[model samples]
Target: MTGFHFTVLIQLLYRVGKAPTVILQPNRTVVYRGERVTLRCEIWGGGGTEWTYEWKTNNGNAEKSSNEYIINRVSDTNSGKYSCMARGDHQLTEWSDAVTLTVRLSKPTVILEPSGPVVYRGEKVTLRCEIWGGGGTEWTYEWKTNNGNAEKSSNEYRINRVSDTNSGEYSCMARGDHQLTEWSDAVTLTVRLSKPTVILEPSGPVVYSGEKVTLRCEIWEGGRRTQWTYEWKRNNGNAEKRSREYRIITVNEYHSGKYSCMARGDHQLTEWSDAVTLTVRLPITPTVIKQPSWAQIYRGERVTLRCEIQDDGGTQWTYEWRPNNINSPTSSEFMITADSRGYYSCRGRRDSFTITKWGVITLTVFNSHPAASLSVSPDRVQHLIDQSVTMNCGGNDTKWRMRRFTGSTSPSYVQCSNWGTMHGSSCTINRLEDHSGVYWCESGSGEFSNAVNITVQDDYYDVIILVSPVHPVTEGDPVTLSCRDKEQNLLSNVIFYHNNKLINNDSRGELKISAVSKSDEGFYKCQHSGKESPRSWMSVRGEKD
Candidate 1:
């Protein structure tokens, strides 16, 4: 038996032996990252003398007795074509087929900083590509651009004084020993100048005492937005007392001074705008106020609200609630009144809706909630069996409770799992029975009502009405008119009914009734519903209750 080399291994795998020839079969290929790969080399001969097996990673002289060579954490570095040799000391030899392994890296990523997009031209822009982890050496960096300049570096590249020629497409490549990566996606850069400009204020200024206006700054030749602060003063006598520039809103008699502005640049202030003179004027000190400070009265209440406006920065101010809380020319106070519980407030109306404490004076006349009521369908003391009943509850938000008693000795509880249906402070529960006694609901804190009770009288097991169809049929159906759970708490599949007589008992679903027939209907449609009372409705010629 001979060892394996590229030539020797190829000859054995071609099967140049006799009948019952021995051949090595390899296991399937393709392995996942971090998983173990097992290469099996077994002979296909029917029978033969005991033969030795050899394994190798590549065509290296290294050989092992085991026909299987294992690789742990099968990464791309561990990938290649592998072959095996099978021999029995000097008896015979055989080799196995070769299999290829492909290693793929999770997508690589590039990271850049100065985070928020806006990258300026001529400014330094850095890009770094990072691969998860693959201890490598001897790397290459490549940069491409529409500007047609060669950009290559062992690691990184920097350009100074970037010009119009430096604008447009950009990309990079990372190459390492035995590994090659493609060029990254191209990024475009548009070069723009960084110069400063100006923004105009109002035309001739008769600047008001305390009025606020804006002076805008512009970049006559740049892509970057400029930030600026404004200053104002008179040009009369003291204009030379100012430094580079000054900013202000108000204009008093002293504000009769000259005014100009200065703009900040990347390095320093560019220059100042030509000085402009200003005149001064007095604007009205507008003020008005609202009373009861509101409108509209709530039920069971009389409503009153008022408003007042005055114009005198100084005066022993005394106010009168408006003309019937409506129109009042003279700045004075106003009045409002509410007969019942309502919302109203009063503020210093000397200034229109502005300077006033009207929100604080808001008062509520009365506080009352709805009634704490109680009622049970089928009467609170009636006996019923095999029937479906619904309980409707109303009045202010409330807590609910239901206790049960077999006779009058031991007490149990009636419970509901989950269902939130409270509208207009009303709740409706359906299907009440003997065990559903002492059912009550009450409002939460400050509800102004006591616990309200809902009664259900489904205690005794007796004759329940029998009808062909039930009241309030839900949607479409040839529904079976039948009974549910037995008196013993066991439920019954429904049975269908025609006219007032028993028909077929099958499925129970939506029930649809065609055109009415005098003989096709009857009073009292009943179906057994054990704990869930059977639903029954009487079909009368003309009557709905």
Candidate 2:
């Protein structure tokens, strides 16, 4: 059986092979230019033989068969039955189903997504087209406008400029591939008008330091004026407001924000063009800065510091104390019941909002003193040695410390060793000559008690003009001076005036001068008017220095 099988295989392999060839197909079809079409044939299995193919058509006269059948751009003459044949052993003929072609005709489709037929001219827009889905080769597109000649393309057609002339019933034709796809439905595109521009009045470059200014924007291409409002905001900050043409009555640092505008034709507002900003530069900088940045108060003792903004900031200004005890704290004048000593800070907001509040008064509440200790009053004073002194001790009070201030500076004087057992809210120094400074107290919690001042006979003066230029001016050079008391201080900056003219101002115990001469000499004084204290002065001097 194996031998017989091998013999059979050998005989099968010895069979002769014939050349593979191609033949025209039956059921032929025709195509038009710019139309998506397919060319099909009646395929006969030529068994394992690759064949070359050619199609020929008989002229419309039906007498002569020309070998020029087309797959695309098919003319009417290329529409007859195309016959295909193979020629090995003899000529075998295969006739295609008849096809009708139209080369001069084309159908194009229009695909578009209008960004509002009412388009703003000079802005960009697009028109799109695709072969309705499955794309093919030999396809060309034809397009015609109401005013221009027809256009042709393989894929897409575009109208860059659109107007009433360009605005007509738009249509397109797709032609060429082997099979023709039906033409697409037509679409109409209409052109619309654009929005008008706006302008600012009063012309910029006008100086407006304080007051509400009005800015108006006019629209020329007036239609139905919908929401004809304006927009105003700062480059920074949470303050933003809107209205038709902005109206700002009071202007300051906050008012020096940014400004921009857009005209809203009802619900739809045009995009803002370029931005315009108003800058309100401050006339002064704060002089004093505090540590812990806030303060806690007891009842009435008195606390204050002197800080000055800029000298040219003018005298028509007032001062305030900022507690910072509240979140988003604001600057204010005196508000605490008494002198306080705690974490605090301050800044100057325009007083136009309202009067400012402050925090620096002292109030010594006579709470229940510890049974194991006693309490005292009159925290500070001057005295000689052997003077009868009173001291109070309280068992309830555990932590303890004493304070002293001189030359407007505060430093620790006494502290508890075993505070848990120590007592006394008040203690007097026994006739001390070595002490002449401001005083305050502290406990274990690290919170300083209300401040007080104790003085002993002393003849020492330390003065530095922190706010003034070091050198004296000859003629008209700006010069300033600072006077120190080495006594009371200020939470606010201090201002200096010599010869009734403003020289320098600062929160530091100092003063300054911008333009000065020998004639500008006179007496100088500093006063912490923010919350406490009367005016304080420096020793009289001449410009000779």
Candidate 3:
């Protein structure tokens, strides 16, 4: 009995004693193809003993000196029930329970966060490699790109501060336990560095006050419109508006500044646009300039007036005149009638309905016809008979003729040619008895000029004559009258008379009135050396503002 028990104990020592347990990494039954798997054989109650492992698969069986059976790269043939056994020096363990392993041909899908194809510079981009049907499996990723890059071993690939050089087609493959999956579809990445452009309406570096202004932020990319949020800035300050267009209803001087804009969309922010300058200016003041350059206007006369504005170069302006009753034209030059006498004002209007200050002017008009002026060469009203005298008709007409009314002539009206030598608008005649009458000028339309009385003296006696102006003098003008003898010599101790009344008895032989007004208009005469001169009229015109 002792020998038989020894034999049984010796056989049990070399035969199976405890069953081995198959331990699988990841503890999963389903796995992807090309995945790495390891089966470890564990023996209970077998301590401190070296053992060889025997692995059984659906395809075949293999023996390894190590207690663990490892598949470097699992394939479809590796998908089957796996069992492991351990062999010791003096004892052996039975085969552990079968562990099923499924090596599937499932491909992984690469997902891109913030999935837009284009990304701006200085942006953070993340690419993820996902394995399908790979639960409970730790995966490592291998990334590929058109642009050369260092290999990475992570499920997620992150690009920080990405730039234009980092743009290319990117693909990734997942590796779990030393097995690699198929590369996913390429997730194209386009890094853009293009900036936006700012545009201003009316394109003015200088704009008038109270004018409308508009600013636009534009982005050009393949001529397609993109939905983006805009940011506008003035003078490089904070954002003013978020819309693509910024408008100002009535721009003033306070609105003048440099402007810029930028855009952000699809998790990307573009660079700020080049700054555009804007300037606002005050409205110009217009000035009214008269063409005739006269303070007084006469009837039957046409005057041209111009509206002038400073700093209006390269600008189109329309004129507006106040006192619109005159029916003024819209041009800068206005033709004014004599009847349109009053205060005139003008303003300039721009194309955008901006206006300038009003410019004012005053016009004075005379209704009645003014007598033509007559000038004599001798500057005196008295002359001796048979003495040569010249007279000229001064006026705005060319049809003026020198005429005289002599009481002794056959007809009362006669031209200077009938009794003297006639020139163009002038006549030279030898003084005779018939010439000692009222001399004047007459136009072809029967309008008469001021008449002057001439006394024909028989000899060079103690005779006196008055020298006065023949034409009407404007108000605020100077007038002078002097007395002369028959020989054309000035005399002293003169007594001046106005309207047959003694006004002055001065010894200067002349009367000087500074700033003559309408009150100074009357018939004036002077007496010198006990000789009284003929009365002459001094006409004065008034100025109105």
Best by lDDT: 3
lDDT of 2 by residue, 394-420 (tens): 344455555444453333244423111
User: Mind giving the per-residue lDDT tens digits that candidate 3 earns over 429-501?
Assistant: 8766557766777789776655555656555567677887645567798877888776677778888998778
TM-score of each: 0.25, 0.28, 0.35
RMSD of 1: 26.8
RMSD of each: 26.8, 18.6, 33.2
Regions of model 2 farther than 4 Å from truth = 1-109, 113-115, 147-149, 159-165, 178-183, 197-398, 401-441, 444-545
Q: Which of 1 and 3 is ahead in TM-score? A: 3
Whole-model Cα lDDT of every candidate shown, in order: 0.41, 0.41, 0.74
Question: Candidate 1 lDDT, tens digit per residue, 1-545?
Answer: 58855644434323326322212222335443455666666665614556566665555564866756666566877667666666653445445555566554423344444332344444665555544433455666666667466467644444444445556666666667766656666556555443323332443354445544333433343334445433333343332333323334654566554455545545544445555565555543323333212232222221223333233344233343322233322334332222244333333422321233333234443333234433444332222344443334455434633222233324333233322233343433433444333333433442222122222345454443222332212222232333322342323454444434554434453133544432333322335443233333322221111
